[model samples]
Structures are given as structure tokens and as C-alpha cells.
Target: MWGPHLLLGVLVVYTFGRVRCQFQYPTETAGKQYQVPQPPTYKPPTNPAITGIPNINTVLVKPPPFLKLLVAVLYGYKINRRIKPTPPIKKCPEGWFRRDQRCYFFSDKKTSWYGAESLCRLKGGYLAIPDTEEENNFLKETSTSEEVRLQGAPIPHFSRWIGLRSLDGSTIQKIITNELLTFTDFVPGHLASRGLTSEPCVHMDYTSSFLWKVEKCHRGFLYICERHLHFEFKYIV
Candidate 1:
């Protein structure tokens, strides 16, 4: 009977202790202890003029059309003044025709092969030497069509002495380079058909349609002189 009474007392004391612990802490109401933030009380001014502050565009004014045009014109004029026009492209001398980087002087008078070469040397150049097909074509096209006579002998065909000749009659070469010809535009059978003679020189035969032909060096013919042309700068005011 004592054990049962003691057990009942222990149980009653534990229950009272739990009740006191619960009452010591305060309780919080739902959604009241931490409130949600409300919207701002004052809104930004809708009319910037009424607020005494100008809009971004108004504060940063754009230049007028005429002012912009004037500024552009002035800038262009300044640039033009600073930058002078590039010097004019160089030109060949008087009575000389320019082609690529070379200047050519076609002779109006006929002379022998040696005479023509000497004259060309005196004039600061050499006999016309065509190293390319384009140059050869130019030479052919530029050659005068005027009749060429030998000692008042009325020759039906005209020709010009070029820079090609074979000293040994076996090895053709350019006098300027003193080397064997690397390029040849000879007529198909002209070389094979021609008989070799002493001191035979080459000429552009108009009768054979600008093909090359071997002839005696003493014979007179029109010739072309060639020289390198350089750029000449000319100033403009």
C-alpha cells in the first residue's frame, strides 16, 4: 500500500512541472508578430517640369542641324588643308611613251643597226629589248608604219631594228643582256629557212606581220630606244 501511494505522488509532480514550463514562454499570434512591408507612401514625379528638374533629353540638348553641318564642313576643310593631294603620278619625258615601268622613244629617222644602238647609248638607253610577250607586242604595235627606204631604193615593206642579233650566226641573244634568247616570237620557219650570213642582224618585218627576220647590219631601219622611267612627284597648289 505504501509503494502505490509513492508512485501516484511522483506522477502528479512530473505533470505539474511540464505545465509550469509551458506557461513560462509567451505565445505569438499568426501573421501579427512579423508584418509584411506596405507599398511606398510617395511616388516619383510624373511631370519633370512641375518638379523643377528637367528631363534627361532636355538637360542634354542636341546640336542644331545647321551647327552640325557647319562643324562637319569645318572638319573636312581642316583635313583637306592638312593633307595635301598626293603628288601626280610620274610621267615619261617629252616625245617618249610610257609602258609599265619603261619609257620608249621611237625614231623618226632610219639608221643602220650599229648606228641605232650607238645613238640609243648616247641618249642614255639601249636598243629596244622586249623580254616579255606584252613588251614585244607593244614594240610591234608602236613601230611606225611609214615606208622605210634604203639609199632611195623604194622598199615596199618597212621594218625596225630590234635588240636581237647572233654574233656567231648560231646563238641568238639580246645585246643588252648578252645572253641567249629565252623567249622568241619568230615566225614558224623564218629561222630554219633563212640562210646564215656574216654579221646578220634581226629586225621586226612588217611584211611578215611583225615577225622577226635576219638582215645585213649595214641596212638602215627605224629603231626604238628603251629606258627605265621613275616616279616624278609634282606638287599642286
Candidate 2:
């Protein structure tokens, strides 16, 4: 007994309800499709602080404290190998004695002052000149030593010629260098009382306790030669 308009409206409402129940609105996680989670591929470590899941090709390594120190030592040794060592210096020449950085050669034979000068020059040196008390005493001791006696000269030889001479008999001079005598070991009254005619050359007189005395230039006596020492270098393995 309902009106026709009301019946029509009821039918429309029923149709809308059935459509909504049959197909609902799509949700946030719908049945579109689900992908399986794949394993991560291996990669070289870029940062040591970051640790990743372990894989077949991945390995984490850290150097020990001693290993770093050993590497540093090896690097220093390699740098040192590039540098060369200094060569060693050589010593005195053959038949020459070294003293206070000077080389000396003692003669075995006796010769006049001029002859002695020539012989010393032939040996690449000049007649020995004593400049200090130490040097003077050294010459005195060596003159009477067994080293000189072994040269067939009698022990305690009376005198030995030196490089001193005075042409004017007033000013003493070194014969070869022509320099004025700065040091003298002359005996008292030796130079002041000596006559000019008989004495011009000087000699070391053992009788005067190895003091200097004026004598004739023609007298023969043993001599000494001196030269500066030259140091050399030799490479060693």
C-alpha cells in the first residue's frame, strides 16, 4: 500500500549499498604486488668507521701498532741508503815521521850546510826549522836517539848543522827563508863573543847541552828535513 515515489527511492538506496559491500576502496598496502627482499651486493670498504653486513668478497683489515712503526723504519733506511759516507783521510808518507801535523825526515849521512840544503830540497822538503821550544826539544832528543845511531853514526855525535847563519855576524838569519831568527837556543856569550872570520854558520853542539853555536860553513854534520803533511782519502767498502 506504499506510494510509487517512495518505493522507487527505496530501490535506489538498496542498489548503492550492495555495490559498496561487493568492492571496497583500495588500502595503503593493497594487493598490487609484493617484492621479495634481495641480498645486498659486495663492495670495497670506503670508510673504516662504517661496518657493513659480511659478504663473500668483503674483508675488513687494520694495521697493528708495530707494523706502522716497522714501515716508518724501512722508509728511513731507504732514504739513508741514497746518501754516501765520507772517505777516510790517509797518513804520513813512507820513511817520514808525523808530529803535530808536520812531516819530518832525519838524514843518516853528514854533509856541509850548503850540501845539506841541497839534499833536503832533493827530498822535496827544506832544512828543518825549529820555531817553538817543543819543536827544539824534539829535534834535540831525536838527534841523539838510537834511531839515528842505527844509521852507522857513532852515538853522541858532537854537533849537527842547522839552517841558521849570519853573514854580518850581528843579525842571525834563517839561511833558506832569509827571515830573521825569532827564536834562539844559543849558549850564553856564544854569539856575542864569536869572531866573524871563523864562524858564520850555526850548529847544535851536544857539548853545550844541545845549545846553538856558531861554526864554519864548510863543517859536515847530520841534518833534518821538514814539510807540511798532505792528507789523502781512500774509499772503503
Candidate 3:
């Protein structure tokens, strides 16, 4: 009963079914990637009411108890003078007498013996005489760093004179001012141009450690004259 026409019809139906299935839309749509923006984040306000907290008071900070005690202790010491500052000690000059806390130099260069006495009288000091053992000892010690007596006047010898003199002009002797004199028995002598053989002058050299030495008065050298420390210093000119 089924001939060629029925066979052709079945083939056409099968072909049509295949073609329709090929043209049908798929269940899943084609996907496209996209980027989206998020909402802004919030920030809290600075006011105390919003935060529900009390404000700090910066004015009234308390010092530590130990700190206060330490400060008080230091203040007490400063006010009370618990540790008093020591005053400086005054030192007198070596090989010199301290008069009113000052050192006086009688002579430095050659001066005549009598001239030296007169000079001392004028200046306000006497021919330095070591009155005490201490003075004599000080003189001896200050006279040299080495053997003073051993080194005999630097050998080549710078001749000078001392205040020691004789009224009779015979022997070199020590003399004193007659009274408790404010000024010397005499004055500091200088090497002036005196032709007289009796012109023995007094001289002093600090470095040589030679005290007033007696020499010819005519010698040319620098001389020093001492006066009381309390004496008002001035220039005659």
C-alpha cells in the first residue's frame, strides 16, 4: 500500500524538522560584563554631644607630689643659705710685705746708700730690714732658686749699694729710724752723677734675687721707690 510518493513525503518532513531546529533561539542569552558604582562612606562629627563624651579641661593639671616637695626643698636651701659660698682668700706677694693687702717694692736698680735712705724717707718706706726670724727666713728663701750665697753676685758683678751706710763713713752698718716713724729713716737712692768716692748707691734686682746691694752712686740703672699702700697714688706732672 505504501508507494514512492509516501516515502518522498516522509523524507520532506524529516528535512523540514532538522531545518527548524537549526533556526530556533537558545535558552541562555549572550552575556556582557559591566562595572557598577557603590554608595559613599559616612564620617562622624567632632562635637561632644554627637559622641556622648565630656570635654577635657587643659588648665588645671596637678604637679606630682614628689616634684612639689623637691622644688620646695631647693627653694628653702637657696633662701636660707644652708651651703654658704666661700669667699676668696687673699694671697700676699712673695718676698714682699703686705700693707693694706698690697705688695711694695723698695728698689729695683742701683741707688746710693745715703740716697737710698733719703729715697725711702721720701717714698714712705725704710731700708728693708728683716726685723723678725720670719722676715729673715723669707728673705733668705726668696733670695734664690739655687745656692744664693754660693753664686757670688753673678761673677762678672753688677756693683750696687744698699741702704746700709755709716755716718762717720767708715764701716758699713745697719741703722734704724729713731722713732715709730710713718716714713723711713731715709729714702730710696738712685745712681746719679756724683764724683765723690763716698757715693755708694743702693740697687735691687728681682730676677737676680739680689737685695739692695751697695755700689758706686754714679752707676746708671733703674731704681724703684716704695711707699705705703694706703698712700694716695698720683702723678706730680
Write the residue-wise lDDT of candidate 3 on 1-237 in tens digits: 678989999999999999998873444532534335578878757576676453445223545444544554455345333323222235433444454433444344444344444454444444555434464344435434323343554333332333344344343344443222122222235223332246433344443445444444434343333333434433121
Provide the lDDT at 26 for model 2. 51
Residues 1-237 of candidate 1 have per-residue lDDT tens digits of 799999999999999999988763334644456556699799776775676564679545865544544554455345434433232235666888789878888877777776777666555566787888989988887764334324354544468888888877787888856788777888788777785456468888877777788877767688888777554322221
* Cα lDDT of model 2 by residue, 1-237, tens digit: 478889999998999889888974458547657566699999867887977566544332544434544554455345434434322224555877778877777777776666666565555555788888998888888766724456465634647777777767677787546788788899998777886555777888877777888876656677777666553212121
Candidates' lDDT values, in order?
0.70, 0.67, 0.42
lDDT score, residue 230, model 1?
56
Q: What lDDT score is found at residue 126 in candidate 1?
A: 65
Better of 1 and 2 by lDDT: 1
The TM-scores, one per candidate, come to: 0.53, 0.54, 0.29
Clashing residue pairs in all predictions, respectively, total 0, 0, 27
**Per-residue error at 7 for model 1, in Å?**
99
The 10-residue segment with the lowest total lDDT in model 2? 228-237
Clashing residue pairs, backbone N/CA/C < 3 A, model 2: none
Local lDDT at 217 for model 1: 72
> What's the distance in Å from true for residue 162, model 2?
1.5
Judge candidate 1 at residue 184 and give its lDDT: 84
